[model samples]
Target chain A: MKPKIAIVSASGCRACETTMLDIHYGVSALNRWAEIQFWPFVLGSSMADLERIDHLDVCFFSGAIATGSDRAMAEMLRKKCDRLVAVGACAAYGGMPGLKNLKKPATAEAADRGDLPEELALPEQENRVRALDGVDGIDRVDAVVPGCPAPVNLVWAAVSALVCGGEADARITYAAARLPEEMVRPILSGLGPPPGAVFAGEKAVCATCSRKKEEKRFKAVKRPYQAYESTGRCLLEQGLICQGIATREGCGGLCTGVGVPCRGCYGKPPATFDPGAKMVSAISSTFETEKPAEIQKIADDFVDMTGCFYRYTLPAQCMLMKG
Target chain B: MTDYEPKIIAFLCNWCSYVAADAAGVSRFQQAANVRVIRVFCSGMVDPSYVLKAFSSGADAVLVAGCHPGDCHYISGNMKALRRSFLLANLLKEMGVDEGRFRLEWIAASESPRYAEVINEMSESVRQLGPMH
Candidate 1:
């Protein structure tokens, strides 16, 4: 029997839809075992069609819960589906829009000041904008596929595993499909599965990066906008704030591979609490300063510490924002 | 409210600051009885998460006391701690935590009076700021 699958987009940029479509040739293989019952982005399913559905085998819920309607839709889907998989980072860790948690919630008065259109003039429903995990009844999801837009191969592996009557192990599937044999040989050499092997690999991005790490100390940290020589050394060693040391591995060190620093979009290692806190600890330990005033001077070079540290996971992790 | 006692979590380095705190107690230095000290091997060993945890877990203020520069048991451990303090301070500011709520100071093993003085000053400042939210 074909498993009935439903795909829902909540409040994200529709990246998850792209991820699903990126499966490309693999979709033909998937179609043999499963039927996509409801996907508004692809199938143009209306709300009436969703309400008419009595049962669903699996539901891929993408995007963060950003409105009262989104919460209601999530609850409805949870009740109608046997299994619900949170797809993409927005659904799992709140993604980029989660940064808004740092600011005060929008008010009716602000909306009325000609800043927003008439349709958006009203205040958001109370407690509407939230991370998917923060929602009351749907906190415990069956599986989480975390990424800005989850890698296509990983998505294929996850959906395929589910269709094949097996649990989707993101770690095993991702490693098998993405990692080269040479890389896997050293990693599998007498080593247990890493600590946080859920959505991404256990080690930091630096583990996969090819940069040389000679000395960790730096007199001054450089912003990415400043010109510097990339002499096959670690970006952090060259005074750039490369977050590879604190970020979870996966994405195959895409940003760092192109000489750009990682912004820690993959969330934190499973062992850590807050990625921002881990980053603060990691970066601070490398500053070569003994004097109090000199430390402050070096720290001052990095403007907007919170924005840099909690760029992606602020809404989901920051203690102060957890009201 | 006038008699409200503030709770301060003090991370004291075992080599210098912890000894200084002990000396203050043994010498009967006049100090506020509000601080709860947690001894660490060195200031560098104190992760920023510990400080954030202290604040979130009902600490009215957090004091990180280390050895004077160039005097760490592990060479430059205190310096590393100093750098961490700077990063933590900015992070706290970004989080909208009051500036007076977190402090870092260096006190030698013999500076019992300085320890008492710093504690007293921190206590007064935090008392004025009231309890952490």
Candidate 2:
């Protein structure tokens, strides 16, 4: 009596192969508690086979948002699945396709290359791509997995938990930082913050990093090369631009710990709130310089590195490129 | 420190890095033994975290070698790698980690000798930066 789970993948994402491979190996390690079914790639034996599939206990949607006939197919899966989960950055956060949220010409050189198939061809304009959350009338999704092709472990763990009925205790649950009741409550009421609401030192990390000789802090603002000293002080305090202050702290600060800046992969509303936007606003006022474009480019390139993870998903939230 | 030799993991793209590394070996270029090469389909597959993973897993340094920006075998894989490297370096600096632990360079298949030279250069730089913990 194994629990049944189905995965629905689209054409452009091309993650069906990788996800299938991961699931095959991942389930081998699991206690064989669930029966797996994949659509399109695996069970597309015939049109009758598609109709034969009824509402599934669990369903995963992977790939970028598609339109025309593809949209109808996606909607059908959404209706037939009991528990719907968005896997992979494209499905979960709109990946490269979501970049249309911001009005910008595509800058990714890969977008023009012929490696990816023609099915992924975006609309000629920036208004085309949208996150699943942005699709009108869609309510909350059960869960989301982020990453270019959402890491194999993420899919395995989430599905395993659902099958075991301990989904609430899943380690990858969404845990956004709690904004002040004063700021959030009013915003919920449709009232924006006061004109001079300066966001400074709401948390200890921000306070400690911005400390100006008021407390015992590390001297000398270190750059990428010099910050490697074995001191545990925040790099931002030492005059280096660290995005960890605004970035979510799940990745074990891998970027900061390894002599790089936080690219904001785990930050904000992957659909609306851009991690790059928050980072620049936080530092722009502090690190004032004449050459603003140079600093902006450095920040832009950082977010672009995550590719579809950050850029394509929350194009509007991007600090430099907007999209 | 007895002439600290940096242990570097070089992720060579199949077309460029692999060919260049092999050429270096064939040309008998005198390079540091510290660098170990791993072949990947393209530089785009080299996630930024992979660089951090290498360093944390006892690698003194990690180098992501690819074809020049426009020369990726899979079209824009190198460009993606470049974009990723740009972010990775900044992320490392933000984390209070030493920046020299990661290096991103481009080398052509015809530049096997240059690949060896780059490896030796990175080893020297990491040696000066001290061991990453």
Candidate 3:
């Protein structure tokens, strides 16, 4: 049976338009034997039509939650939908506007710099923008396709997988692809040392790509406490802020290759440890540099770059957020 | 007001900027030798970081010389260089570096000597601005 897929998004029409366009194009390419309905933007229809629709196998939630109405609608969708997929970074990690959540508590001095654009300007609002994970019951989100606007290829693959009853395979594969093969092999083997356990020495995480493989299973590896080494060695080893520790192995290690550091979109996977937290801890452990000023500068620089994708995973509770 | 030298790094594309610089040299234009020219296969081959690196490495000014925008030998290498320069210039200003330190100029092989004149003029302008931190 062709699973009926319905996509529900927030009030913003511009992003919703782009999302629908990508999904429409993706679906057309897959030529899947499935029927899909979109709420707004490209569908040229109303949400009232959604009630008439039934038996949806996959439900997609796209766009950011900006207004009270959006929150209400999203909650309603969560209850009504079977399998909810978060589309776009906004839905997954809270997009550019989500960065507004990290604003420091108001100080009279800092508040004086409030000459930002209308949407960003303040007398800042009291409640920070909520990530999708902040919403209750939305936690069981099955899949996430990220990009300020989710990439068409990823969205297509996710949807196609759902259509083929390959959601489990896709979920594991998603994390597997993001992770290095060495890590994946042990993970599949159900062995010890666990994910994010900090293997000693610079072990390439994947063999197919670059991870170093061990002949025998290694256990109880001690965390290597190396300081920041600038020779472009693996980020984990240098204690120089590498996302390889926390980010899923897939990406074929993309960002690190291109020179932009990993922003941690993979976030903390459900298993061993949060990758972001581990990397942060590693960086903090090497703070024996003795120069407070230099350490502060490095901290600030690391935050700006690494924090790009931090809000998605760093929970509202981490001290790193206070920093 | 005074004769000054421009410490400029000219990233010339093999097809055009290289030719233009050669033309400038062959013409015996008698321009300042302050400019250090680096030949690249394509202007697009130049990364924006290279421009930033040049500034940090103490070049008073960075000039990217390429074929006219649409005339790149690799089909838009010059365009890519142009876009990159536009972005790098804005970024440099944001980083508190003097905005005028980065420049992008299009030159053809036949206009090689014109390259030397440009170097002398650009160097003089930057010398007036003093060292960029």
DockQ of each: 0.70, 0.03, 0.01
- Candidate 1 per-residue C-alpha lDDT over A47-93 given as tens digits, one digit per residue, 9 for 90 to 100: 78999999998888888887777787888888898777777777777
Put down candidate 3 lDDT per residue, A1-323, tens digits, no spaces.
67767767763334633654565345464346467664555566575776556546666677656455556656666666666777755666554545555553343334577644564434343244444655654656665655445544455445545554443354454353343345334434434223222111122222112423222211111123434233444544433344555454334555555433455553443342334334443343334332334444444444343243354443322222321
Off by over 4 Å in 3: A11-25, A51-55, A104-126, A137-139, A146-154, A166-242, A272-276, A287-311, A314-323, B1-133
Task: For candidate 2, give the lDDT of residue B107.
Answer: 93
Q: Judged by lDDT relative to the true structure, which candidate is superior, 1 or 2? A: 1
Taking all chains together, each candidate's TM-score versus the true structure is: 0.88, 0.45, 0.47
Q: How far does residue A132 in candidate 2 sit from its true spot (Å)?
A: 2.3
Give the best candidate by lDDT.
1
Q: Write the per-residue lDDT of candidate 2 for residues A41-132, one digit (tens) a residue.
A: 66554435545678666666676554543454556666666666766656655666655544333433346564544544553232345444
What is the docking quality class of candidate 2? incorrect
Worst 10 residues of 2 chain B by lDDT: B87-96
Which parts of model 1 have CA positions greater than 4 angstroms off?
A24-26, A108-118, A121-128, A166-173, A176-197, B1-4
Candidate 2, number of clashes: 13
Model 2 TM-score, 2 decimals: 0.45
